[model samples]
Structures are given as structure tokens and as C-alpha cells.
Target: MKNQAYRMALLYDFYGDMLTDRQKEFYDLYYNEDLSLAEIAENYGITRQGVRDVIVRAEAVLTELEDKTGIIRRFHKMQEQFAQIADALDGICQLNEDRYQDDALEGLCAQIRSVLSDLKQE
Candidate 1:
């Protein structure tokens, strides 16, 4: 369906717990596990159309939640800000190293980079 897997995953991440257990299971199988609708239907002992309907309804729920809360939008904005901060830190470190060659400054820069790395990982 136009390769919306990434968007679907992000929506699921933000709002998946709101879904019923059955909806979550089918959504995970179809989207996260990359299973075809037919495969999911086979596994669940349902028609392919039934599996598709569940996934589609789950996706609509996720989209509605995102529209109302805007949490995912804010999250992406925060990530962009963090990336900008990391880039600025990198530039400052480069300038400090070029001008001063101070070991203490280098150590501080290393710590900052480590913190940024950890944040990005999370």
C-alpha cells in the first residue's frame, strides 16, 4: 500500500497500546513482521480480507490518535533539535581543537558526544 511501513511503524509505536490485543497482534504480523495479508489470514484461520480489515482499522485508529495528540510530530521535532545541538557541539569541538589543543576541552567534548550518542540511541 505505497510502502507506508515506516509511517505505520511510527504510528504503532506511539499508539499501539490503545489497540485491542487481537488488533495489535495482526498489525504486528502484517507490518512489523512483514507478513503478507494472505499469510496472516492463514495463520489466524481467517480470510485475507478479514486480516486486511483489521489492519486497516488499526491504522485508522493510530492516525486518529496522532491527529488528536500530535505526539509523534512533537517527537520528530525534538529529534531534529537534538540533531542540531549535536551538530553545533561538533563544530565547537572542532574549533576548540584547532585553536587550543587542550586535552581537558577534548575530554569534555568526548563526554558531550557520548551523551548525545546515548540520547539518540534512546
Candidate 2:
């Protein structure tokens, strides 16, 4: 999945708990299929502008849900921090002829486990 789309899908999974039928269909088509508004409009037999409006409203609802609940934001922040730490650990793993490299890698690996555990608890 595209990165933005993946984030949007997570947002949907969180916010979709509250969408109306038409709103859910619109969001699923636009984000999941990579479809253009015009294409979705054609499929639904609505005007392009009408499709655009519906999509915009749905996006707003999703955003509102995320902002209110903050689950998606927390998930994104955790992923980013985890990636950075993983990259740092990879750099440490590359160090040669150094005892500290082993220590660093072990510490980072443990930190990664901690992060995963915390997320699971959440």
C-alpha cells in the first residue's frame, strides 16, 4: 500500500467505527483503490464535484476522529521513533573491532522490545 494510503486506512479503521454507509463506501473507494474522484463519481453516477465534496467531508470526519482519539497519531509517532532507533541499531551493528558495538546493539535490541511491548499494552 502507498504510505499515505496506509496511514489513511489506519485512520479509517479507527474512525470507520462511526461512518454512515455512503461515507464508508466513498472512503473505501478513494483510499483503498487509489481511484480519482472523477472515477469514483463515474462509478457512483454522481457529478465529479459531488464526489469531491463527499470525499472532503469524509476526510474531515476521519481527521476529526483521529484528532479526538489520537490513536493514529500515536501509532505514527511510535513507528517513526522505532524506525530511527532501528536505523541506529543497524549502524551499531556495522561497527567492527569494537566491544562497545556489541553493547550498543544489545541495548538497542532491548529498547526495541520495550517499545513493542509498550505499544501492545496501549
CA shift at 87, candidate 1, in angstroms? 1.4
Instruction: Give the per-residue lDDT digits (tens) of candidate 1, residues 1-122.
Output: 65587889899988999999999999999888889999999988999999999998999999999999999999999899898988999898999888988899889989988988898888
TM-score of each: 0.80, 0.59
- State the lDDT at 112 in candidate 2: 71
lDDT of 2 by residue, 20-54 (tens): 88888988888887788889999989998998888
State, as a TM-score between 0 and 1, how close model 1 is to the true structure.
0.80
Give the whole-model CA lDDT for all candidates, comma-separated: 0.92, 0.79
- List the pairs of residues colliding in candidate 2: none
Ten residues in a row with the worst lDDT in model 1? 1-10
Error of 1 at 57 (Å): 1.1
Name the regions of candidate 2 deviating beyond 4 angstroms: 1-3, 76-122
